[model samples]
Target: MPRHFRALAVQPKWHAHDFTSAAAFKAWMRSQLEMARPHLTTNQPNLVVLTELNGLPLVLRGGRWATPLGTFQRVAAALFVGRLARTLPLMWREGVSPIRALQLADADANTRLYLHTCRDLAREYGVYLCCGSAPTPRYSLVGGQPRRAPGTLTNQTVILDPQGQLIGVADKVYLTPDEEAGGVDLTPGDLSELRVFPTPVGDLGVAISLDAFRPEVIGRLEEQGCTVLLQPDANGAPWTAKEGLPPDPANLRDQPVAWLESSWTASTRGRSIRYAVNPMVVGNLLDLTFDGQSAITGRAEDAPEPRSYALTSPRPGFLALTPWVTTGTPEHLRRAGRERAAGSGHPLENEYRTDVIWADLTLPATALTPPARTAHEEALSAILGGQASRNPSRVAPGLLAGLGILAYLSWRGLRKR
Candidate 1:
């Protein structure tokens, strides 16, 4: 069998429920991370890239907290702040305190702390945890400021090793006007350099979601000698399982192989860049997209054309590869962090656009080439405890089985009442 590493690309969705309160957001994050962990361990890919806005809180306001939330909260109800306020008293009276309400008062404190812990957990599990689709730049004209493209403080991507230790951070440098169209004052980050780090497997490049849409980010990664690109993003209408996608719970139509191919070729044809098409993988809780149809693509230096594959079974496992050279930082991130820490928002003054194009990367099973299974597989297999003996149809067969049972009981009580 060919040596194949699996990448668990994750797109963690934070809906209104996720941000209603700090606790909710944190709990949601923990749950998502836990769910994604199994896949990460089983499919120890070269790298695990998350393509969602996990690092930052989408704040909003209302409830007893009476706090203003993150900009993402604005994306929730189309209604304005005034409208959300009207319903606040009702929620407070009825003892309804959403997670977003708590986030507004203490945004970074808990968020950063949670992220720090999450990174550690990821490292402990031996899965590379990468966060993307965080806050980026925005087109804003707040506080009588000039209508320039300013660095809007949004979400950020966090990187962790198998032990979930903090490896690096990637701040998004692009933002779409529509994302910030209903502005409560937003800005954009600089068009910074791509950030790469050395992993036990190979050099990995991580860029913001929108940044990947541009040839520059991918080219820069290749220039930096990256063998894999891990992109974690939350995008578009919920995905469907057609056209090559794994089964989408949302039941939306999909364009699988084409989706997978677009990500694989992101940086393959850029100027001053001469790396063969590095297999780009995208991950989310429910989906895994690979560029080459099969997991086993030829060596990085010699991949076959029109790459495709076929698989007889659904083989999702934890994977890992050898590590390579890791070094360097994005000048903008350092400068911005320093500037923000020093209370000088000078870096926030710039005009730029972050347009991210997501390509679906679901290939047909037959087109999939299985990667080599190593001790890494055995390690994850041990962790999973090989519960295949049970019926796979039972969704919450693990620890969550208890929660499912509890929910069932609660429902029975409510119906009786």
Candidate 2:
């Protein structure tokens, strides 16, 4: 009989209060895992995946003054004021701006909290956990303590075994423009360094966010005999808004339709990679907002055509998809966007909710067998041929606005000093 396993995709809402302290963050994470407990099976392996940059909010831990600030600007301002002595010198020494400097100053603490929380959760749940990504400089555990080293910052994902020990780490290779020089200023991981992690369920390949949209990245993983793909994402735009210009010439305005070209389109394209899980983070971080439906996709053996499956309908490829609570329609989503701009909107307008979408999937009889490139690949070639118009550059407006706010605040602080 073929081996079977359960895959859980977590769609978590980001809240500033959750990061009030290490204890609070861990408790929130535990609660999210608890939501998945009912779906797990004792007879098979379980793989739990969270969204990209899920741990990035931990930077606000210990910022009790900023907990009630809610909006990104106010909280950032509070953090900047509270940690001026540390951020100022680090900013000057590292030749970085105040925004990046604040992140760096708390990098070590963020890593410890993020890692320990996920590690403990994996052990408690007895599952293989992909703890999502965190933006931090490279570091190592020295005497069981996280020690930082001088290096470029990268969005890195960690995988922990059921025993609560880390088994894999994959840094994001392809970065969005916002993650480049002008935005968060993160360094991209080398594509050559991508690794396939072995687990009881199957061989796992992790493609963080935009990385999943690249054929080269997917091909490299398939070449290494990967059976399952984990694409943890945090979409920075309205899920119902038009996907921008040019490539979307037909005026294809739906975000979910445009998103299909990545994970759903990849796994069903006649590769050995049989299943994919995409967990998206929803909610806003200051002027920056992320919204998307989390989904699980798979290729069934008896399907008439090579099509991907999702949990929710209206789309064919997804086996399971988490629904948007408040921004389900275009009008409502646009209204929410407007409210965010005016700085007056109900928090639920961003679809801030925690959901878990999971499915029992069959694993390949042998984990090392290479997948054959079939006609399915040829038929679906167009999907991955050209890049979608919805690239990271679209976030420039929000980033610019946030930067302006930071600049004004910094100038005022300097003048007061």
Candidate 3:
């Protein structure tokens, strides 16, 4: 079997109630897997990547806690500054405190279910898989259960092997301003410590969503002999809009920004970047819509432009990328990680469902295309995780705006209630 093989991106139409029961969740996943199973060829190591926090709905099955009460509270809090004054009494009489609702939902059972589901999928499909990302507690696997060390939960990515072995977990290092206030109440990962796991496909590294935006995180991973960047994302917004709160969740169409950014980013960051899987969270949960523009992106050294391909449906669909290794000996490929971007060539195959989109992205991986680093580049990369935006001067200003937004959201009204 050739070392290079096909990779499947699983995009599911996840509902708020799917996580209520493990059986239901697994059933949903199985259906999607069955759809993609037809494309999985034999004698090749198959890789499956999902979006970020795709399993979070399991914990959200908790009653009113899963309601838009969180969103209501957030916006109301933001506007009123500490006075749910009118809303509090209304909620009190209605009988469910948004605060209590938020507390009631826990990832304990959800986490276990998530692990079991991914393991089963890997074992069943006989393919390597990333259970996508989840907002799991700051945890360590002691024995078999995931245990936290008394810190805020971290947005996590669980990597699994074809044999169903647990490889490594990558955490979301950078949280958006909105994430800080509401969302998962996530605690960012230590930027200095990155997780790159050894996979059947060379050394595999994962950057959950925004982590790819910084040059530092992906830069260091590339520096560490890591290839096959598995990015499980949950960016809930239209493609064209660069930044800010997303619009209404009712729109049934998806934009192309997810793949667009990743494509250009791969060119700038030096690697074939892929997996901008829209954290497709669909349902009646706080005005958030994770549309299905899940994409597979990469760049070929010979090609003038980077490749960006994704689904257009807002429902369920996926992008298939057939990985191509350089026409060289095993030893050459092994050391390729240190010298150049892993899988520097083009994608041999790019296929998808929904609309049945297909493309040929094959390129020979021969030379090193790693960009030279400068003093300012080094310092900035260290600060930011990946290259999200090209404007270096805007970095400090972006940080300031984020800080200001965070401070505004931290107002008393938005706090917990």
Candidate 4:
């Protein structure tokens, strides 16, 4: 019997400085742990996948006026080093005891440092760590720079066993201009190379967030003997009438499920998430945006509902999953059958097959202590927090002065209505 495992998707609020100043980032990360600890201590999900940090870091190289608008590109470079120093320890201390396997969305030069640290942390926790690097610049010529495409970009999902030795890697095979831009040229990985990582849980496969959106990608993974597909991404943008969602879109719809050409993940036969819709981000409340319902869909034993978890869900939904390595003709036969059946099930893959055992993953909700806001963050958070916080007094003064007023006068009704 396949054991049920509790799994949680965490998208921590991160800024440029977080990784640059490991101490500060660690402290902030520790505080956020309070929000997740209850879930881990209670639900004990066997897997935890953390979202990559997305905010632009402060300027790193050029003069402020000459530099780009996003963030210090260098900060992305520093991320791995910071993770090694601070974040990885937290994983070992908290997640390691309960969460047996962990994954993350990797970005930037710091990714190198982060991977090395993850290797070390895997040892400390006696757990496995898997992370994927972002695609390089997407455009053939980015920011007026050009380079040859590398067969594989740095930071493919580098897998480390409990002893922290490198095992397998899944380089991304698809590329968009954005992924190709900003720095080095990226080479998409071979699609045929996608395979499962034998894990303590089961034969596991991971498709980075956007990777999951491509039915072909997930199909290939499933075809290659993968049982569980873990997709980690950073999503949550303004909704459009054209966008169609509320995510659980069982009834309402332009389409029951949201589909975007640029979505982070898609699968051939099982479930696909339009976006990570957890409300962990501060602006999410006002914008009504969310990322990290980290929604999952697959059939396991016909439960009343396909398994799903909110970041705030109760714990113990996951159990300690031990994947005993098994290799046999039976495994091969199963894989072949799945592969043959894959694309028929969807357009993305030609043929793919796999097995999955499901169980409830209940994670207890913990009190969320919002991370302390720094002065620099006030601007970003204000937009997310709500429009109500905008200075009403300032608006009132301007209104009283009739500043920059544009009014229409009607014959009978000239009111501000």
Candidate 5:
């Protein structure tokens, strides 16, 4: 029998104030789903997809002073001061930089607030939920509870069944420059560990943010017979901004056009993957700004040639695309800032301008059979059963204690200055 389902790509505009507490974050997430409720059908399976780094804001949880800050640097500084006791020790114990340590300090809280909330929401809506990626250490389920496993932090995405049980996780295989050593310092996941999770809707494969740009990542999943590709994204640059000239400089294109070539165009042009959902996280996190038009792309039998959209020129295979309030140029951004400072708010700054783009998709009949578990899946299953051993640390305890003391003294001296 042919299976049909509704897939929703949720474009969320995040604000610093939303991460003030776990309750606030969950409430905000619930409201996003509420907006999609009317479009969902009771007769068919539903898949709810969120954007990448949507859960990254939860690192500000419990840090009241940092939640209101306007820039990433300021927020990080305030968070370090407010959670000094916890972050300091983690930095020394993990032998990682301050930013990485802070992420580690809040890893458990992030996991609980993010996954548990998604779990509850999935159960409430009876939808398969893909809780987007977060910058956190690997965690394994022990005794039916999530426990932090010893590992470097990476961008990880989790999928849940309609009953809210965890189906699997896919960590990002490619790391952008910012995610490398000098920035957030996240570790890259091995591409060999990718898994295709089978659901009533389709065989879903997640290729997070930059990972989607890589042909190998998409090819591996296609080889596994994945019918639906979820590309959750949070572009660090403006959507309208023109990137540097490519190898063929004559074909100048904006970020959206380039992204489309790698995503929608790639998936639809003679590919077996039936559908691709790309959800984007927009809005500002101080100096860091994320902006992109969330979209759903697929191949339709009777569909006409693709037409031009707001940001991109004539492009095919787009099923649905969200609209943005502004063009996001430097001048437009400056004007928006001036308007906010003068007590008149710009529509671009409205965090409540959330959108959910949905498309009804038909799946191939062969997509129902679940594939055999790969080796990575077997290891994940063992970890869920609490049979996996914790990784041992090589650093001496006394050396770590000394480093902690030194870091504390440096922090105190900087404050004194």
Candidate 6:
């Protein structure tokens, strides 16, 4: 039987450097959970969501900036450099790697603060909490449990149950250019490492910001029976217009807000999968404008109402989704079947005039009949990919002839010597 419950996506405005004090950071963290608590009120277990790197902002806040930026130009310069070049020498003196610098000072303590705070929220609310992503060097969760690393680091997302037990972890598979500049070197987590976290709502999977852009990652999770793709994101300047470009659309490179949402919608299309809840970061970090388009999308033609819903603002609040389990409509089913029959569902929207998405969703059974690949198709792909093996009988004569020539050359050379 299909299970049902409430799922909340919180897209709060991140105040950079507001939590410079450890005490203040922890207090602010609890308040953020308090903002999300009311939305999760339910007898059934709920799944609470937050954006990627949500905790890292606090970590960064705790660390003092060596160079202060007073003007917009200075901020822009800081964003490009990511301030790592100036800080690397200082970090080395502390006996730590450049990669560890990204998580800032007192890395382990700050990380524990973030984790413990969220765990408390989960236990308090009795909700399954899929906490935000963060870059940490000293700590990691591997194989659904804590894996303490003295040096290694990854951009990881952690999920906890109502009782505050660890459910799963998803490390990012890709990193942005900005992260690389910030000395955030991460080992990408593979498909096998990305496990599905079973919750009261459904089977949950996570794809951190950059991972969400990789379609193959999502497809692999779907193949492994994921019902909802929890996308924790912290994006910078993808929505801003190109400053020096020509007025003509062709001459300039800039995408409209709708265009960005459309691209994200395409990611959830045709898979017959249920929902995609994306909670994104917002506010200015250095000069980086974290775009605040947190959205929740569903399978094509599945929900009768708006399957694609988004929140544009970063105000402290919650966007809740109550999942109503049922079979797809005939029209929706026809489109899905056509996609299955054609061996591909053509990738195929939402509330008007609002940044936040608050709505009910129509979903189906967690398990569905996915389009299976035929042997002939698989063989063709293998052949095209140069993976097909050559026949042993065809190569034996050539191998023997080559060996014979080699032996003859050695014999002649030895005789001449």
lDDT of 5 by residue, 1-417 (tens): 788899998888777778767778989789878978988988899999988988877777766565456667567655655566667777667676767766787676566567667877888988998888888666555665555665478888888788877787889988876677666668899898887877877789999987887789888988888788999898776555666433344676666667876558546763668888899887766666677778888774423456433455555677887765555655664454334321234553434236899988887666445656544334344443332223311112233445555655644444343
Give one clash count per candidate, in the order shown. Answer: 91, 9, 13, 56, 2, 3
* Candidate 1 lDDT by residue in tens digits, 1-417: 223444544333333445544456557656655655555535434354544555343443122132233233323322222333322332344332222222222333333444544554565556666644444222223443312122224445556666654555555555533333332222344445345655553455555544555555666766666555655544322122233222232543333333333333443443322222122222211111111111222222333333322211112211221111111233433342233221233554211111111111221122222223323222222322222222211111133444434433433332343
> What C-alpha lDDT do the candidate models reach, one value each?
0.37, 0.70, 0.49, 0.34, 0.71, 0.52
Candidate 6 local lDDT, 157-262, one digit each (tens): 8777877766666777766655543334455555656656555666777888766656677777766777777888775543333321212334543322332333
Residue-level lDDT of model 2, residues 1-417, one tens digit each, is: 476889999988776677767678888888879988988889998999988987777767777666566666467666765666566667667776666666787775566567767877898899999988888676544554434555357888877788776566778998876676655657799897776776677778889988887888999988887788999998877665566423334675566666777788777783767788899987766557787778888764422333222212353455776766553445665665545431346654544556899888887565563233323222212222223222211101123455456555763554343
- Model 6 lDDT, residue 410, Cα: 32
Mark the 10 consecutive residues where model 4 has the least summed lDDT: 96-105
TM-score of each: 0.47, 0.78, 0.61, 0.46, 0.82, 0.63
Sum up the clashes in candidate 2: 9
Error of 6 at 82 (Å): 17
TM-score of 5: 0.82
Question: Pick by TM-score: which candidate is best?
Answer: 5
lDDT of candidate model 4 versus the reference: 0.34
Q: 72-158, model 3: which lDDT tens digit per residue?
A: 345433322222332233234534233322322333445555666777778899988777877665554455433444435567787
Question: What ranges in model 6 sit over 4 Å off?
Answer: 61-99, 102-105, 138-147, 181-183, 238-272, 300-417
Best by lDDT: 5
Write the candidate numbers in order of decreasing lDDT.
5, 2, 6, 3, 1, 4
Q: Identify the superior model by lDDT, candidate 5 or candidate 6.
A: 5
Better-scoring candidate (TM-score), 3 or 4: 3
User: Which scores greater on lDDT, model 4 or model 5?
Assistant: 5
Among residues 3 or more apart in sequence or in different chains, the pairs in candidate 5 whose N, CA or C atoms overlap within 3 Å are: 70-286, 71-286
What value does the lDDT take at residue 103 in candidate 1?
26
